[model samples]
Target: MKQKRDGGVAVTGTADKQPNAQLTSWFVRSGWSKGELARQVNRRARQLGAHHVSTDTSRVRRWLDGEQPREPIPRILSELFSERFGCVVPVEDLGLRSAQQPPSGGDIDLPWAGPQTVQLINEFSRSDLMLGRRGFLGASLALSAGPALLEPMQRWLVPTAAAPRPAAAQGPGAGGGRAARLSEQELQLLESTAAMFREWDSQCGGGLRRKAVVGQLHEVTDLLQEPHPEPVARRLYRVTADLAALAGWMSYDVGLQPIAQKYLVLALHAAKEAGDRPLGAFVLSSMSRQMIHLERPDDALELIHLAQYGSRDSAGAATQSMLYALEARAYANMGQVNKCHRAVRMAEDTFCDVRAGEEPAWIDFFTEAELHAENAHSYRDLAYVAGRSPTYASLAQPEMLQAVEGFRRDDVHQRAYALNLVGMGTVQLLMRDPAQAAHYTDQAMAVAKRVRSERVNTRIRKTTHAAVRDFGDVPEVIALAERLSEELPEVAEPA
Candidate 1:
């Protein structure tokens, strides 16, 4: 039958029963209630390490009443059915395919040139501001991949330039706008504003000023549309790219993975246009960090390799040290202790070689404190791989203590202090000292309550989960359990 749908003419397949009918048939054959099926799907998704997959009985009931699921969920359901039925139950067969196509335009891919890069920054900033943080969680998996990710890392070796200087005679939106007359004063304003944003992010956590940063990015993107001399244009692109990267980093801090990926990709494009290979390499390192957090160490390694290949001759010693530190993280996660040690040595050697005033301003945060923190984390992971040995556990403690002291001296990044406490608590737990571990865990939770950061909160949750799991019989552990329920009501109760 032919019918009009969404103001367009449509054709229906004769074999296509109502989605509800097909869904009901499957439900009856599987002999599982809607709630049970939803629960099973959620359980499987979690096993697959997929985040933000929420399927409830009421949602399943709606699906069975002829409402099609949005993207990814349909795909997720197909996989679940295939596993249960021992056959290929495609998304099409399940009648759950969404009508909307995935995002394609807006420079979702890198190497975006000139005006397209400007368009992407503007579009992404607006979308991120409007959606806040939670809305992007749905397509976090899909947007994290695709050509957008692969092509950029593969091409980071080749430097690209921004658009040619438009004639001053050109009008608005025609290669040149009113910015042909831009002055050094205006450029300095942009740089200083970005620095302020970075400082705020470092001190208070990103959530407090995320929206304001987006507004700043929107203004910068508007400035990019104007025509300028080649030198001014290059400087503008670099400044705008830095702001965009900050936006992405803040989004990541708040646990918005998809939005972070989008902003970072666009930042890479802008950096490329600015002809700043080091900046582009830094952006690639950020992408690798995100990939590692997502538990894709292979992907993370690929990105680090690209950064190394591109920045080999150009990057300063400080930047080189940061890259090597990140590489150590990847190797550590993969349980390659030897390679991890080699990378750490290289990082230390390069860091010592850093000459004062030679390093770029952006690399300022990669201090000795940060290096020790990274090593501490790497050692902790290596300990797990080496049968949870007491040796690595002992090694992790001093580094963590050093990290804590550094963060405390700085007095800006309270979250880092809290994170180190969590690490110390974990080490204590592994050492079979439940009482001391509970004390550190309690301290971390108290500090975490003051920070508006999801990242810090996650670290606290992991430490508490460990406490509730291993030291449940202890009084301190019981107190921490009550604290978790009160502080993080949304988290599932420990098993």
Candidate 2:
């Protein structure tokens, strides 16, 4: 309704008249979908000291139908568009009334605000560099005991200390050194490098080229000490956080548990510095993943709960789906079949609601393949705990079969592909399909031999042992066991 009122000017009417073309044009230019635009509105509402504004896609649809929303929305949309488009988007732009003062956001109550983590990251990375240079952490050490890990989790959940100033400039890479003169090209290079590292880790597993990744991380950590333009600084921290998280995953993949913890802590700190809550939540999930791997499902549950609680109000549906799925894995590990089932159903439901453009770039990994892979795991655990009962076994089969096929299609994620093969093969064995089990097991062994991930190797070993112990009477199982022996002769789990 962009009808002009005063002096015969056109403006949008408050009635459901013609489509609100003016409002549509601006947001379309900003490249946000209806769901994403709705999320931004709700988030902006919270920042402006209002409760979640009960805004969603349907509300957005009504606004587009030339129906002006009540007070805060018009005001909120005006400012939100202004920020997004990097131009003054007055109420007249969207034909809305924004003639009120915007509420101020509440002060952050948590401790260690702003760039305080710069100091922490430098110290941790430097120490890592020194120790790693000497091969000190080359061998696995004991993982953080459950009680010892609680302190960090508590700080993340309820920080008490106020913000501390960043460290002095005399530190390495500080006081206008390499990072001080960072150019756009250099920043782009760093971003591309991080992306490349992720792709590499995906294709080849985390065991290969780990040292090169860590070496690059140390150099970039030093660059963090020097200040840069605001935009550059933000991107720097974001890339650094991504690198640290990837490093942690690689460490975990290689079975260096304690080292993985340090990298994860660094990732979490960097994410906080960047003010990227979603990335921070992802880091917490990674930490929970580590805990699950260690068989500490209670700790895993707590860590995932912290992730859920921290991002409950603002995280998109895709992220929530992943968090719920991770929660399901924790439940599965604890053998809480009902709780696991509930969490899995929630994950599946949330996933269905995820719009194409609602998820961020990093969430590109958690698609149908990943979800089905996780479900297969949850049901496999349940079946195991139920003594491989046909009931749960039947439930697991389709998911496992689907996930295996899905991973097979994405050959770039080598470890996932190999690991899911092992899983599907094991489930087949549980169903007493000796020939099918052997077929999948041999294929899994062949693919696993190409990946350098010790974690994958360890799990495949477990599958091998299970086959010998439970399906030994089957002739095909005996054949697959001999094949595994031939392929991984004298192989031992990583220290």
* Cα TM-score per model: 0.79, 0.70
* Candidate 1 residue-wise lDDT, 2-120, digit = tens: 33221121323233545577767766787788887777666645544444566778768767767655545665566556535634354556766644545443235444577888987
Evaluate residue 212 in candidate 2 and report its C-alpha lDDT on the 0 to 100 scale. 68
Which candidate leads in TM-score? 1
* lDDT against the true structure, each candidate: 0.74, 0.72
On the 0 to 100 scale, the lDDT of residue 188 in model 1 is 89
Which residue runs does candidate 2 get wrong by more than 4 Å? Answer: 1-116, 119-135, 138-142, 159-179, 492-495
- Model 1 sits at a Cα RMSD from the real structure of 7.3
How many clashing pairs in candidate 2?
6
How accurate locally is residue 251 in candidate 2, as Cα lDDT from 0 to 100?
82
Q: Positional deviation of 375 in candidate 1, in angstroms?
A: 0.7
Candidate 2: tens digits of C-alpha lDDT, residues 39-138: 7766655544456365778767767777656556775676577546433365567866543433221111122544555655565556656665433443
lDDT of 2 at 385: 76
Model 1 regions lying over 4 Å from their true place: 1-72, 75-107, 133-141, 146-148, 160-162, 169-179, 491-495
